[model samples]
Target: MRETSATRRGVLAAAGGALLAGCSGLDEFGESSDEEIRSSRLPDLTDDGESQPVVVETMPIEIERTVLAERVQRTTDLLATLPMSFGADDVPNGYVRKQLIEAAEDASEYIQDARTAQSRLTAMRSLQRARSEARFAAAGWGFVEDGTTETARQSEHEAVIEDANALRSDHAYLGEDPVEAVLFHAEVEQHLAFVAENRYPSGSVNTDELLTVAEWGEHTEYARARVDDGRYLYDRFRESLPADAGSIEETLTTAGESLVDELQRRRSDLPAEPTEGDHELVWRLRYRVRDAAESSARYAGDEPGAASTVLRGAEGLADFLAYERIRDRIDDGEQFGVEEAADVHDARDQAVESVRTALDESPRAGLARPVLADAAQQIVAADEELARLRGTVRPARLDDPIRRYVTATARARSVPAACQEVLDTLTQ
Candidate 1:
């Protein structure tokens, strides 16, 4: 149950050089248009046998109420200090950050107005890159045969997978909102894969390389702004982190899970021990603490046996996800109290609590939102159910009920804004 400190650190520090290599073009992320990203999620209903229409969520409630009217001013001071941290190199990455800062500077000028809406949407789009693209790649690993030559070869799939290694941030999954937000996210991810699979690079039968990467330049990094430019998306996204109290905690929890998953995915290639990113890796070790707490809390009688059984069953997801800790995260969400989800919630909650203190200290105080813990718990749970269904490898054969169930469940992400407001009032 004890993961060596060295093994743990390996999970946090990714091969940044390889993972971030191609991020350089001045117009890289800017090339892709929003329509392209949104269009991808439109379900290839070409298979009329059983097709689904493009489903987008809509929340008519006012988001301006999420925070205090006066609190808007508080965020301005905070946003001013953010862009400085994104590194001059990655600064000009995109226009997201630039717009966020502009919105922040004009805080008094545009408090709770359309300006906030515009800038926030821009920021959300940047964040979507992680889930819609990076995650699509990482999760696509699910498509490869477990014990094939492809697994050992590190082929084109690796390029596709590695290209999207940034999916774990808060921007990627902003707790459900207007339908456009969810649709854009789902579409971008869909497009990343759709284009990768269909487009062929010039002068190459191999067809695996960046054959159509240029085409995505607009929808992706190409059309994006220079890193140091006022428009740097990444910098702004991080700067304007939610700061809604527990936002930072959630980001750290997510980062921690991401670190572990990232490392675990490639741990086989690491040295016997790891050296950097120890900060991020600690979240994995906390899994044991989570597991033990759960055992004590639940099946205290036959708990050890139950834990062992559950643990063994989840090995595939753990390793594939690159971190055994993901099980802990997945366990906590304990969605619908159904068999698959409830199994992992206990441990995940413990892991979230474990990272509480330090995460609060991070800057983008906004990222410190309470959703950190809950999000980890829920994502872990949803992923578990998805993983359970995946283990069967029966996507093509899903029953009518099953298909609707999974897709509907996935689409049912938007929490009514009114519900959140009610809870916010009670808690505050």
Candidate 2:
């Protein structure tokens, strides 16, 4: 019933009065009716909607652009000050520290690029992402640093609470549309609520440190970025709404059908029961595939909110597929101690080989520009993790190594699926 014919009826009309009260002058946008959205025809994806006015909404964050840019640069500089490499003695978790440093560097680049960006909207989005990444690095560093004091952590906890409160208001202005945006909106809302309750979301990455200052700050800032990103995407989708509903509907229908079929295939491929050495992991992945199938099936017929269901299904399907690959290779039962380091090393080597093989099997000698670009990024990430694991893997702490191994393995495994999706999109 949720994915009934009403799904697309008012995809853009769900912005009720309560939600619009906080928005400045955006009330008229929320006042649109289903009939109005349906009747106002616009160019489809292929056509350039140059005739339409550019509706670039204000940046979700209230901070001035220059100030935020400076903060991002400062965070990046702080990260740069740390030694290029850290032993176990230098940091609590070298793998996580390395990732944070890389993330900060990336944020700095984005902030600088936004300065020269021609589009105001694009620049705002880049700035929001940069700021979020910088904050994440700053907060996560507290965990990696050994000498962090309780007083400093308490200060960070208070700052994070403030940040979380600000994000709740900022998120209110984002319109509910495009299944992707809606899903992200819900996640942001949930994360914010968790912050208020001083708890972690279910199945969160930060399971151990539910109330830790560093973890709380990192989680909150990550949610902040999601809110900004979701709003940016919703605005983009609004501008790109096709004048011809039939064309858009047909495309979504075809994609949905493909996703459903893939979901079924993946479900069938999954082990009927949990296997040894990966009992929990296998079942977890199986349930994920099942959940994706259920979600896709909800939007079986092209209905109003079917797009949301389908989009949710696609994301779940990707995770399910990636986890399936992970389950096959991980055997914690066999990995008892430091003596099994060879197995971990071998896993890394195998993951690298799989990525190279995926690239080799690419269509047109991998000349497809989009596929090549995506695969190249995944390859680089895998290589970086591989190198980091090699340098930081100590017998004293296998947790970090295992985490990095899985991260690299999952990225390598997902490359082929990503490639296929790109090819399908191009063909369509």
Error of 1 at 115 (Å): 13
How far does residue 405 in candidate 2 sit from its true spot (Å)? 2.9
Reference-based TM-score of each model: 0.21, 0.34
lDDT for every model? Answer: 0.27, 0.42
Residue 95 alpha-carbon offset, candidate 1, angstroms: 32
For each candidate, C-alpha RMSD in Å?
22.9, 20.5
Least well predicted 10-residue stretch by lDDT in candidate 1: 15-24
Stretches of candidate 2 above 4 Å error? Answer: 1-126, 129-246, 275-346, 352-411, 414-428
Badly placed stretches (over 4 Å) of model 1 are 1-124, 127-343, 352-382, 385-428
- At residue 99, what lDDT does model 1 achieve? 29
Instruction: Work out candidate 2's RMSD over C-alphas.
Output: 20.5
- What's the CA error at residue 148 for candidate 1, in Å? 39
The best candidate by lDDT is 2
